[model samples]
Target: MENDRGTKRSRWRDDDEERQTAERRRQEKERKRKQKQERKEKKQQQLDQNKPDDNGTSEPKETSADVNGLDLDINGLLQFKAPEIRSCRGVNNYEMLNHIEEGSYGVVYRGKNIDTDEIVALKKLKADKNQYGFPITSLREINTLMALQHPNIVNMKEIVVGGSLDQIYIVMEFVEHDLKSLMTDMREPFLQSEIKTLLHQLLSATVLMHENHVIHRDLKSSNLLMNNRGQIKIADFGLARFFSEPSQAMTQLVVTLWYRAPELLLGAKYYSTEIDLWSVGCIFAELITNKPLFEGRSEIDQISKIFDLLGYPDEQNWPGFKSLPHGKTINKPKNYVKTQSLRTKFPMMTSAGIDLLSSLLQLDPKRRMSASEALKHPYFKEDPRLQPPEMFPTFPSKAGQERRRRASPSAPVARHGDHLNDNKNENDDDDDDGFIMAAPEDEKFGLFREQDKKGGGFQLRF
Candidate 1:
């Protein structure tokens, strides 16, 4: 019995030794695995430090050029992957189509959505040179467009960035035709009813912009786009800015030359939304006459033209006009004080229309009409009544097709592919100074029925 018990004890001791050996071996293997993982993680962290951050920015690191044409250093070829020209389709589900046109700011292209198949206008902003980073103008446009949402305001679809740090693309709702394009295609000047429709839309859009504290520094006809549905939407916000207070100083070098306000021309350091109203007035005149109201050759010529028509500004008309930066330099006409008259320029315009125009074109910035006030102007309520947007005609789908059919071969025809040119000549763009006289006086009518001189005013209907 004693021998059997001793054997059992020896067997139990051997089993215990084997269990201890296995545990130590398991612990040794785990320690080795952890050490290997630590080394791998350290290497990964070093690599991540060299790569660009989430915002597409990276810390400046020392770079040394090697004979292989690769930057060799701690932040070397391994740091930044070569800029790959990848299709935006796999990246953001947008397939770029043909190039539309390039502007001073960016190149615009027609794009399609792979998911929805919706057409979009893709504007690729020009990247700034090294160290400057993303353009502030691009940032401003993106921030502004994202905040504004209205039927009349052009819609920004989404932003798509290329694999390369340099490429930035803004996706916007595609607009078929701009007013400039439409005007070129029209057989005759827009009719009075159509003018009312266009003005109403312009005023409505302006009201929305002003309400949002946004100032469209550039409000040219080319920036106003109209779809086939006759819905006009304001576009091109590269020059736009948000204003918090009226007293805030804004750059006078804003609007395009011809549409620039008198105060801006006089180098007023402080201005308000009145500057936009001035552009609106200019646009209104252009729409009615089918030509620029004041087509000046230069900045100096522009101010001179305004003075020639409206008479030289004085304290009597514009308080503190001479206090402006350029006011002192502008030479006044010798012994010539001209009386301002809209009648002479627009003889066929209705009285209400003239009144609204004068108010919008007021020499004093304070006297200029506000967008909301302009919408409520008696001119809009007067005859002929403002036409519905749906009634407005659409431009030809194929460029110059309608114009060619309407205009004789002898009549100057815009070239077949002229619209495709991205770099449009400024001189050619603004050449629509062809004055279109207002409709004949006999053809005009009032919106309301004329009251019998002796009879009670026309009864109101429910």
Candidate 2:
């Protein structure tokens, strides 16, 4: 009877132990499931916060990443490294050569790839930090350049990062000289045929940008780069962006003062590709006359300068004239006295060229010539037609550059019916203020000198 009682007690103990083991396992499974659910929720929150709202449009949504405010951790974001720039510290990868140019964005240097023995332009971006880590300008430039591939657009080979975020380098295809530098170096003004070729290339590139839904906010002679083969590539896209939707608002403060459009000067909140067309018009005039079309000292003066040449925008000229942001406030009396005939100003231009210019500089943004339309203009299809890049005249090197510069006379002073006067100054390059966003001019009387040498007497700007 004692043996039977002991056996019952042993069986009860075994059942209790088994039950405890099952309970512990159930508790462990419940904890793991809860942890997994929490992790999934956290991941979804991150994705939702980062992704932009899809409003059912084909246009690339302006995300936080596109603008500023990206939390950039080089360590985490350094997942992408170009094979050419794999080695850091500038030793094994690239050998830094001469410093080329320094602009608002960064200092550009000529560099060589150690591995491939290729020359490249290394643009070191200025890492100015706001609440957002890096400047939106840099981000916009990087993203835009990466997406673009054109003969007339600067080619960005790859990116090189250093130990810190500040040491970022944009590897770009190296070109011999910028238009500004080349203009200064040239011994003669560009030939009529040469000008046509240059304009064709420029407009071609502009068409590519518009087709790709990009807008180059800053278009100036300084930003146009050219190689020895007469290939013109548009560079300096610090202010460029993918075209914004009509409903979205963008900053009006863009483009250099001399190249800024009338609508921007009037504080238009929403602008389109027409702004770039206006800039191209200004550049076109500059190339022909060897001087800026409208040189304004301030925002107000800039508007006045435009009116002085093109007449003020009234309801007749611009449909929603008074409705613009500062349209009514700053719309002073148009300087009808300074309004001269473009034909009279550019006596050398063909009728077709004049027509194209008028279309581009139309007061109504709606009427402004688009890149595509401009490319199709009769000017390009004229008798001489556009010449290939290879046919353009070659410029002499430094040995003869100074003589060429000295030989060309400053363009005659032609402001408000001024007489032709000879002004001789060799180092008479436009003030550095020409590069500034709000470039101011000291003189109201304007003169234009042809760029470079052989085309004529002292190329002059008054």
Candidate 3:
């Protein structure tokens, strides 16, 4: 009986050990999953914070890029095994050279096609699958670029997925410079003509996007591309999306705050292509004033600046002034002390400039000036109407010795299975005057809007 009892105790001890082992494993699994969720949340927050006003601070201003030839790759959270590109169905036979840029996403490398000796900018997603997570941004950028094409729009030659399910790369045209560089290079604020020229082409590009139902939710000077040839092309469509029906107003949180229009600022809903036009108008204002028109720190401050310049909004002026998400806040502009005035702020501007500014600054989106209509505005018909065609960008072949144009603007990206001779030109990629790295562009807007003191009115964004 003693021996049997001892054996039963030993069996119970073995059972307890097994139970402890299983519990340890379950706890470990739970910890790993929680860690992964935390990492994903952190990464998304990083992307959002990259935009200015996120976390209440601004990102470093962009700088000039070397833009030689190389491919940078980014990885996302998904467990993707990169395919072997050395074989079929890969972005092979391309040589990556120098580093062009490092943005919030990843590094961009300049590349040359081995088959035809053609040049391109290859973007590789950066991040580890296990650590930094996946490259949702690369996919978003590429997806938007694939279906879009226009004179004033940047073009994506191809998107390559390669390397054992781990390394993926996207190949695209390497633009020489963005408008931010142009703004930097010019000592003087862009001439009215230049603003007109840029706006006209931008309008053409936006019109194309609208036709295709793509909304470039993010439009800014930095997003505009310029080559030595004087041409400007719109780039960066990752933030853009299709304009679905009902036009449910997207997050007023898309474009850089300075370039954000009034309706978006007022938290207006039901946005459309009209929003893009508002941005265009703001860009025009910035180009001439060398400053933003309606700059505000917080949403309330931003709307206040607009009201001070454009005057207070009565339900009479903007039928539904009191119906928006935060309509009541704008009810009292004269009460706390309105800030400065846009006119006095930009003392150098002419009366005509003021007229144009007010027109674009209108509270109501419907009453806002349309691109086509603005193009014909008398304000632009001045001594030097928008930059003359001769002064703006021309075909790649005509871009001159500085910019190496291997083909005509109309040339095909591929010839007989070779992508080496894509007719493309690189903009000399630097600008000194775009936005002073000293302060953010939005801050500049606030300064200008607060320059002079105008009373009894306020600018309403919605």
Candidate 4:
């Protein structure tokens, strides 16, 4: 009984000691927290006392000295300051006038700046559910537009945001008409001088782009915008990117099917600015003929149409033709002729113009005419002097008043495995006896609207 009582007493004593130890630890923790609070209060008080008053008068705070023991004004010594970050304005600042058109990357709207009353094109970027964050194509378009600033290139005024995170809009200078719509509405084809003027402006913009090491992978008639003053502005930089020396392997699935280059159609992975020049060539032909130069439905048909116009490209013309990824897959047409029919196609075009066109549409990318070279071509210097922009006739802007009814095909969305397929019609490969003529007259021409005939056009004042 005595042993049990002694053991109980010892247990009690141990429990009492543990409680005392815990109590002491709690007290120490409380003391440290209180001390931290006091120090924070003291520092805050010192800062308050040192801070300048509303009148800009205060006791001079002690300045720390550098390693040389010389007092320095930190603000004066530090010449660099953080750049002020300005948030984008809300989209509500602009009143939505009408929906212009939806493109592959964004939905464009005709808007008016409420403050300045200036009309602007507001392009709200499309959200991709499959994407995790901002689309890379949209990001490239923004970055490219910001980097390139030229008169003939679309001007990005500012960026505006809507209510949500994905609701971003790009504010740009509003252009009156797109070339494709204008050509569709025209009663007759453009005059030679007018065509020359338009091509000159396009070449100028392309020169600027190429000089900056940028390649506009997509260049179609619908992508070119024209104002009332006849100024041309290249739009849609979703496929544009900076190219470096020793060309890199880029996607072959760029540029629309109608304007894709022959090499690209043949699956040339490492291409440069020549692909854009080929598209420009297609646009040039479209401007002359009042229709798309190569209106093929599929990749095979497109290449066949190209072959029908420019003849089959062999090792003599396009070196390393057999080495391309999809080059061997193309079966040469048995009945195909080996002669270019550009002269027969455009009989009315001057020899200089034909030469320029041929250079641009060369089967070999190495032989393709560059934008700078095309700008100085003799076609512009030939008879019928280039029509000045102001002299060019104005047209009714369907974009401002109403939505476009007959829009051209949107740019091809970037995807994989869209190359030439084996399931295409075998007849397209076998039947290549004659050149494919221009689109039928009725299909190419449209009745001129009353407003267009009356010379009534709209123009933004500011």
Query: Which numbered prediction scores highest in TM-score against the true structure?
Result: 4
TM-scores of all predicted structures = 0.67, 0.67, 0.59, 0.71
> Per-residue error at 299 for model 4, in Å?
0.4
Number of the top lDDT candidate: 4
Using lDDT as the measure, name the better of candidate 1 and candidate 3.
1
Write candidate 3's Cα lDDT for 99-208 as tens digits: 76666666667778899888877776666567655656566677778778776788877666667555566776667776665555443455445566776787778778
Model 2 Cα lDDT, one tens digit per residue, 121-179? 89999987655487788899989998888999999887788767788888999887778
Clashes of each: 1, 17, 60, 0
Cα lDDT listed for each candidate: 0.76, 0.75, 0.64, 0.83
Candidate 4 per-residue lDDT, tens place, 1-462, comes to 236556434678779999999999999999999878876765676577678989998875544433445643422243434658999999999999999999999999999999999999999999898779988998999999988999999999999998998899999999999999998887567767777899999999999999889999999999999999979899999989999988998999999899999888888889999999999999999888789999999998999988888888788888878788878986677886667598978877779989999999999999999999999999999877787889878777998885435557655322243443447576664443233333344532212221132231221111
User: Candidate 1: lDDT of 18?
Assistant: 100
Candidate 1 per-residue C-alpha lDDT over 53-138 given as tens digits, one digit per residue, 9 for 90 to 100: 88998864433343455754332334456766754433267887777677778988888888889888888898867647788778
Which regions in candidate 4 have their CA more than 4 angstroms from the true location? 1-83, 338-340, 402-462
> How high is the lDDT of residue 272 in model 4?
94
Global Cα lDDT for candidate 1: 0.76
How far out, in Å, is residue 183 in model 2?
Answer: 2.1
Q: Candidate 4: deviation at residue 366, Å?
A: 0.5
- Quality of model 3 by C-alpha lDDT: 0.64
Local lDDT at 31 for model 1: 100
